[model samples]
Target: MQKIDYREWGVDTLFYWKLLIGLGIIVALGGLSALYMEHEGHWVTGMTNLVVWGTPHMFAVFLVVAASGALNIASIGSVFGKKEYKPLARLSGLLAITLLVGGLLVLVLDLGRPDRLLVALFNNNFKSIFAWNIYLYSGFMVIVAAYLFTMMERKANFISRPVGILAFTWRLILTTGTGSIFGFMVSRQAFDSAILAPMFIVMSFAYGLAIYLLVLMFTFAQDNRVIGDNLIKRLKNLLGLFILGMLFFTAVYHLTKLYGTKYHGVEYFFLVDGGIYTLTFWLGHILVGMLLPLALMFCPRFSPSRMALAIACGLVVIGGLATMYTIIIGGQVYQLEMFPGMTVINEGYGTEVAKYAKYCPTVPEFLLGIGGMGVALLATTIGIRVLKFLPETLADESVS
Candidate 1:
């Protein structure tokens, strides 16, 4: 085997420096915001008892789920003998590890006692969905990181087939664990279904692809590397399929809820009725997020430039965020008592019943949530610069 050297592909001096500086600024601002939130308290954010969790949790989960799916490229290529996917293997693995760390950070910051994170490991709640997620996510991160490091070492002759298999298996379990966090809540009509688990798995694919395309485009732009048009076209086609699957699952899930007359009916009404959340579900999740982007991606005549792909990726990412919000926020929007038979007969189901609860994050909460994203971006940028993470060329010898 020939030894591959990365320096052959000349470094992008201007691009790398600018990205590093921008990342530093984001990290500094985010750090300051976090400090302010810590001193002032959770009251600064919009979160209330009704909405105990907010956008930060949603984005954090989104990042982890997306990260797992990104790891699939490497797992599939290594385990399933998929040669076409080899091009994305290294980058996908890197993104998976980086994003998971970022997600974990945001989740910890959201905790009431950020310092009590270790307690999650000791205080085992066998029945709690969140507890299981804590364990699975931590383990999965370790496994993926190990796999990535092994691949990075070109001197290693025998790839650990068992390690690859373990990674692939764990990702599936990890995704399911993530979904069960929502699905196991039988009290919450919005999430009490087996469909949510698979829905999350599919959502992972959508979000992962969106992130991959965005990152790939940026890398290509900076490095002036041309990924063959055929490859780009194939990727777009696959993305289109995933988007369609997501849309299909969404429709079926909601339709089943509406068709059945029970607590689910009331849950459906919360979305269909003229409520603020209904607007978010219909406008943000469906129309703008899924339908429009699907239309663009599926249409052949539409020019698939870097800009177009970026916009589509952005929409899909937003859509994934909205899905989590709809599941978590929309589930709590309507009180449990509001269900048809459960409502008190004396109340006669007045406006109060239909009003549903409200929750908005405070400024400090917003700052923390935004700051988490800033931290993630900063880490990714810095990692690329300091660690020589991103290859200067698609076929750069260093990657091999």
Candidate 2:
């Protein structure tokens, strides 16, 4: 193994200071939002009994799942002997750890009683998917951080292989746990399917790869790091394949729902009647997010530049976020009728029900979500600068 000295990978002090300033601002804004939520209660946000967990929760979950997926390149290289992925290993590892921390922060702050967050950790609900997710996420974080540390230590060759395997195993379990969180919600028609778990697993790959590509572009642009065009093209090709898989799963899931008697009404409302949410799912998620980017990457003439890749990545991420939002919100849009005897169903039976149980996130919630993104970016930037995680110089020697 060839060792690169930390001194050779140092970032400029100006960039480091700027990152700190950005982090500080984000922290201040998040703190203020938390305080406001605490004082005013959960009423400040769009959350109600009907929509107990809203956009913030979806964003947090997406980030964590995406983070785990980002680490796959490193995990695959170390455990599965895929040497081509080694170049991305260090950056992906750092990103995985940082994004998990950021996601956890958003989740903790969004809690009605942030102090009671420990209840989820201490209380054991063996049957509950949410309970399992808590454990999985914590375990994944530990394993990934340990693996990252071992990788960072040039002298620690013997431990890296074992740590890498552990990280990879735990991340897979963690993603499954995340998927099961929604899958086990039997009461919700949108999430009751067995396919959601696998769907989320695939989604993790799409989001993870997309984020890694974007980060690569940003790092290269800012620091003049020499990532080969060939590498970028390879990643884009892989991403295109994942996008196809994601689209397939999405289509089959919906098509199967339409065929099922239990879920038909809910499926119809989301696919046809649900207004902006439906539009978002069909156009934003399916067309722009998946198909268009796939075309840009896979089409020979349409091979994207670094800037174009970044834009595509951003669109994919936005679409992924919207997909999650639609799932969570769209599920609740239709209310089930408790009264069985009524001939004419209530106006609130389908898409109309969401209007009554309405939720538009308050300014505070939006600010907090924005702050989370800031925190994630600031953390990544600082890690690159000070932690010697991102390589500043390309190694001439082959990775062992």
Best by TM-score: 2
lDDT of 2 by residue, 347-387 (tens): 54355533324667787776776677667777788777666
* TM-score of structure candidate 2: 0.91
lDDT for each residue of candidate 1 in 256-275, tens digit (9 for 90 to 100):
88887675555555567727
Per-model TM-score on C-alpha atoms: 0.88, 0.91
Question: What would the TM-score be for candidate 1 when compared with the true structure?
Answer: 0.88
- Give the per-residue Cα lDDT of candidate 1 at 236: 78
Global lDDT of each model?
A: 0.71, 0.76
- Which 10 consecutive positions of candidate 2 have the poorest summed lDDT? 1-10
What ranges in model 2 sit over 4 Å off? Answer: 1-12, 337-356, 394-400
Clash list (residue pairs), candidate 2: none
Question: Runs in model 1 with CA error above 4 Å?
Answer: 1-14, 338-354, 388-392, 395-400
Report clashes for each candidate as comma-separated counts. Answer: 4, 0
Cα shift from native, residue 297, model 1 (Å): 1.8
